[model samples]
Structures are given as C-alpha cells and as structure tokens.
Target: MTSETYPVDATNRVKRRHDRGRYDHATVHALLDAAALCHVAYVVDGQPYCTPTLFWREGTHLYWHGSSASRMLRNQSDGQPACLTVTHLDSLVLARCGFNHSADYRSVMAFGRARLVEEPGETARALTMMVDRFFPGRTATLRPSTGQEIKATAVVVMEIERASAKIRAKGVADDEEDYALPIYAERLPMRTLIGAPEPCPRLAGDVARPENLAAYREGRALEDALADAYRTAYP
Candidate 1:
C-alpha cells in the first residue's frame, strides 16, 4: 500500500493540532532512514522504560537488536506494546524570550507489537542489515556473524501500523505585542560537526581517509548530499 493509505491513529500524547501530524509511509520511513538511533519505550510491571538503540528498516518492519539477556527484549517478547521513536534535530531557534526558544526537528513515533525473530537465517540477515545501515560498506570488511554471535544477540521486530511524524522547523514567532520588546530575537542554528578522521594507532604508515568519511566532512547540513554520494560510490 502507498504511504497515503497507511492508517494513522492518534498516538501523539501531546496532541498539538492534528494537522501537523502525518501518517504516510514516506513520512514515517524518511524519519527512520535519516537517523540510526531510536528511543524504544515499553512498559514493565506498570512502569515505563525507554532505552535508546540502533535500528534499521526492511519493508514496513522496524528491527532492533540487543543482548539476548536484555530485559527490554525479554519483556517485549513476552507480549507487550512498545513505542519506537526516531528524531533528527536540525537547528535551534531562539526568540526574544525564554518561552519562545524552540528546536527545529523531524521526529517519528510508532506504536506496534514487538516480536522476537527466532529463525537463524532471519536473525543473521537482521544483524547484517543493522551493520550495513550504519556503516554502509563495513559489512563486507567485517567477519561474518557466527552462530555464537547470533545466539548471543536478540532481535526484535515491530510491525508499524500506527505512526506519526511531527516536525518543527526554522524561524521565530513572536506575539504581536511582544514584537516591539527590546529583547533580541534570532535563530541560533545548530548543526552536526565532523572532526578530523582519527585512525587506529596500530595501523601502519599514512593511511588515507576512507571514502565513507567524505560525507561526514561537514556534518548534518551535507548529510543528504553525503548519503547520495555514499549510495553512488558504494552501491
């Protein structure tokens, strides 16, 4: 089904106007694809626990891995609802007053039932997808995941049926009366910065920077462009 056809249920706790919310698959997947980290919230004994984890997408399913003994995974596998959220902070907007300070960001929150992937091949593929999602080409350079490694890890799959994307971006809004206030108002943009690439101390002689590092040279502003470059260069 197309993203427009994906069902959207009211899952946002804040409920800021419904118009800003979106249910399309494109909106949901785009937010997931832009970042590698997600905050997973689940309930255990009536209390909520939110843990940050690395995640990846395949078709409409979201998969994350954890230690086989992880409490979060165990709880979800035992039958509980979970919420996964992915967010990218693009900038910070500062207005004349503290109340006007805000962040420009894109975030997606998904509610789904989590299941444990018990099949050996499926588990291995999930792990491989996770690695490649983060490092792109590193999967080929690293040793293959062994049976022991798979056994030591746990993979959870969440089928997203109800989800929404909320975004607040750029500029400042001030009350008409407050606009004349003496306080200065302006947006202090924020961005990701990539430091010079560091190499392993054990590596011999002057090793050149890897092609993967090229996209991160300037951080977030160039992230989209870098991603295109990475896909072109690596794929």
Candidate 2:
C-alpha cells in the first residue's frame, strides 16, 4: 500500500527548489525518528530562541523533555508555537565548480503548538517511550525512574500541524561547462559509526548490550540501526 501523506502550506512547503520536498508521512517521520536531536524554535517575550534537545517521535506527534526550570521548556509548554527540525548530513558533494557545491542531506521541518504534559503518570510514560524509541528494548533492562525524579522534569508534546521533508542523495552536480573541466567531482558518503561499548571501571557483572547497537559498531552501518528505530513497532 502507498504511504500516507501530510499537507504542505505556505509555511511548511519547500518552495525554493520545491522539487526536493516530500509530504509523505513516512518520509517526514523517518527523518524525525532517525535522529534524537532536534532543534526547536519558539518565540518568548517577542524574542526567538532555538534550543537543541533530545526528541522522540510517535505517530504524528513529537515529544521533548528538559529541566522544569528550563526557559525553552517553560515557554514551549505554555502553548507557544514551535518549529522543530531534524537533519542528517549524508555526504559531501564535491562539484567541479565551487558554486555548485552542496551537501547531501535528509531533513524535516514540522510546525506545531506545544502542549505541556502535566500529569505525572503521562509524563513518566512519555519518558519511557523516548528511551525505548532511542535505546530500543533497553528501558526494562535498567532501573526505572523515581517519583521525585519524574516530578523535577517537564515534557512537551507537539501535535504536528504541517510537516515536510527534503532529501538530497544525488552525486556531484556541476554546470555542463564545469563538468568538462579537469576537476575532481564526486560524493563522499558518510555515516555515524559507533565504537565498542566501554564498560565502567566500577561496573558489576556481565553486561549485555542491545542487539540493535551491534549495527552501530565500527565498520558496521549506523544507518540501518537508525532506520530500524524509525520503523519501530510503536506506530
């Protein structure tokens, strides 16, 4: 079956080279779930602020958390408008001409109004969801959060109103004349690789890492593990 899609408005539409824009829900959510860090922008007291925080995606909603006293969390939890973005730099496009140089990336921009999740129970669950989504099958393996710990943190969930994703995975593109020049041109691919899991010196007995983490090891493909998270069982 075909994937569902989201609407694009003047605010979220990728107009400037619109050909790169995609409104499909799969594309949008994939970009969000592939990365845990998202930069959320909001206006507080007529001044704009963008804060990079760990984020989680579920269905069409995005969630983030921070200290209860954080200004970004405070402002956003009060129903302030927010624009959240996640990006992945896939490669460096080495074009024959400097003017044609561009990076290959996957990115998504989502517009929404943030809502504070006040109920302690729900906030706690959301935190668990974030952990499960990122670390995957690891939440139950560790110690659970305490009541006091939950109370000191704040969580905000944004129901996406409009979202769009842009992806560029092409090889070097240079002007016809520039391509004729004897200049090096190619796409240097990149991925975030992980090193062997280091154990704490004071650690106890045997430690078992998650299976998904194996894909992130050095010489392995990190994208596969990340993409798997984006397609997790939770919606």
Candidate 3:
C-alpha cells in the first residue's frame, strides 16, 4: 500500500486485453470501495466455489459477513487463498456484429488469504463497519447485537495481497467494415439509481429519518450515493 501500485504476478496479472488492465492502487481501491457486493471464489476439497456477498473495504483489507454455518466461511476460517471481485456495468455496447458486442464496465479482482474473525470485539466492529459502509454513522443509532446473534454470525477479513482493476467505459468497438454497414451500432448507457425511501408502516409517527441517510435521496445514482457514504464514513 505504501507504493502506488501492487506487484503484478501470474495470480493478479490481467492476461487478456492487457491494455485495459490497471495495477495502481487508486484504480483498484476505488472500484472496490464503490461497489457494495463482491464474489469471493475459493477452493474446498479441490472443488471451486464462488459465493456472492456484501463486502466492504478498509484501506488494504476487505471484510464480509455470513452465517456461522456457511460452508464458505467454515472452509475459509483458517488462512485460505481467495479471490474477491467486484464489477459495475456502465453501458451496453451494441455492435453491428455479435462478435464485437461487449458491455462497458469497471471491475477489480483482489487476491488474498481469507480468515474468520473469532474475537468478539473485532467481530462486532466488523459487522458495524459493514452496515456503516452504506449508511455512514447509522450503526451508532442501532442497538448492540446479542451474544447469541454474534455466535450465529461470521465475519471474514482478507488483506489484499495483490489487486488489479480492469475498465472498459468507452463506446462501441466495432470493426471498420462493420461500422460502415447499415446496421445501427451505439452504446446504451446504464446506471443504478436510488429509489425513494419507504418507511415501515408500524414505525412510530414521531420517528424521523436519520442524518446518515441524507446521501441516499431519491434520483441519486447508486454509485454516487455509495461514494458519498464512503467519504463520510472514512473522513
């Protein structure tokens, strides 16, 4: 992390379309922090498995939670090699030829060893951090988790040993002959938008929305809201 870029090896090097690969920490960490979900791939008994879960980043580390009995968590309880990946689809590239069509996206792949957080205090803090990652300072307004609840939950942390970001945010990339054809070709932009908030009907009438949710307003882009949450939570 002291260096601007991570050391690239066979494990983290982007082989295909190497030009699209980014080895800098800024690009990789930005993509990881902006997304709320990630797919963690690990091998258990020589079988490969990829589990999708909500994840958050703290500097060079990534954390996620799941059921204590989860196979993925149990297998990763001890130090085990894992790959965490996050992606954001930016647009749909429509090319005249099917072979040339591809969606534009920003993605990061992080390689590391994952281990369960067994310490009670650290587990509580990690869970709280996960919640506050999307809603900054919201955990303070919530009640503490009971011992039984903590026992049933599992928190895993991975120190990012190496990471690389791959981005393709440009318009359509079609062959020269295909572009001149009559068929239409363009990039259809896409985005995740935040919908208006809905309160529970059983809630007390006097209860008002918390200040932490100010960034999650209607018509806001999901990525932008998350970015705001990250800034507020870290700052």
lDDT of each: 0.75, 0.81, 0.90
Badly placed stretches (over 4 Å) of model 3 are none
With a 3 Å backbone cut-off (N, CA, C), the pairs that clash in candidate 1 are 3-25
Q: Write the per-residue lDDT of candidate 2 for residues 110-212, one digit (tens) a residue.
A: 9999988988678768878767776666678888878788778889999888899998877788877776788888888888776666767777778665575
Candidate 1 local lDDT, 1-235, one digit each (tens)? 4456357544643388555676778777767776667899998988889999988776678889999899888888844799999777877787888887888778898888898988878977777767766566667876687878778899999888678888877579777788898888777666555566567888768866668655665444444643444354335
| Candidate 1 displacement at residue 65 in angstroms | 1.0
Q: Model 2, residue 47: displacement in angstroms?
A: 1.7
Number of the top-ranking candidate, with TM-score as the measure: 3
How accurate locally is residue 108 in candidate 2, as Cα lDDT from 0 to 100?
Answer: 92
Evaluation by lDDT, superior candidate among 1 and 2: 2
Q: Show the lowest summed lDDT stretch of 10 residues, model 2.
A: 214-223
Candidate 3 lDDT score at position 129: 88
lDDT for model 2: 0.81
What global local distance difference test value does model 1 have? 0.75
Expressed as tens digits, the lDDT of each residue in 1-235 for candidate 3 is: 6888989999889999998999998888888878888999999999999999999888899999999999999999889999999999999999989998999999999999999998978987888887988898888888887889878989999999999999997788888877679998889999998898999989977999887788889998888888888888887
Better of 1 and 2 by TM-score: 2
Q: TM-score: which is higher, 1 or 3?
A: 3
Which stretches of candidate 1 lie above 4 Å from their native place? 1-5, 12-14, 204-213, 218-235
CA RMSD per model (angstroms): 2.9, 2.5, 1.1
Cα-based lDDT at residue 197, candidate 1:
59
